[model samples]
Target: MPNAIQDQEIAMLRSELEMLMKEREALLRVAGYAAGFIAELDSFDVPRGAMQAAELLAECVNGLTEETLQDALSAVQAHSVA
Candidate 1:
């Protein structure tokens, strides 16, 4: 009986993990787009009030793991219009 309960819990956890993975992929795509946009933006044109936020976004994107950052940029490039 205990083994059956454990099996059911394990299955539930696996399902949750799959959902989280999908969500992570979606978030990565968003972050990739943000990074691309920030890269193309001119700091001088940004309002003083918004400059701090823009810098924060860039810093966060830069903090991503090297492999993850590559994946993000690849995702952006794949979807970007030429």
Candidate 2:
């Protein structure tokens, strides 16, 4: 029984790790896209501070969940379009 419980726990942890990896990739993709956009801009302007936000976002991936990451991605997309 103890071994079964341990196995279940290991499986749950593995799932969480996989989710974290996916989240990290998504956040990194966001960062890369933001960086590419920044690179194409003619010059730094008032909104140039968005680069810093992207950097922070890249580092915040591990702590976020699927729903939260989705909401964040939507917000980022909206903001970028504006």
Which candidate has the top score in TM-score? 1
Which ranges of candidate 2 are over 4 A from the true structure?
Answer: 44-82
Please give the range of 10 consecutive residues that has the lowest summed lDDT in model 1: 73-82
Q: What lDDT does each candidate get?
A: 0.89, 0.65
Clashes of each: 0, 0
Best prediction by lDDT: 1
> What's the TM-score of each model vs. the native?
0.80, 0.54
Per-residue C-alpha lDDT of model 2 across residues 34-73, encoded as one tens digit per residue: 4455446554562667767645645566356667656656
Any idea what lDDT model 2 has? 0.65
Q: Give candidate 2's error at residue 62 in angstroms.
A: 20
Cα shift from native, residue 66, model 2 (Å): 26
> Hey, what RMSD does candidate 1 come out at?
2.5
| lDDT score of residue 3 within candidate 2 | 100
Candidate 2 lDDT for residue 48: 67
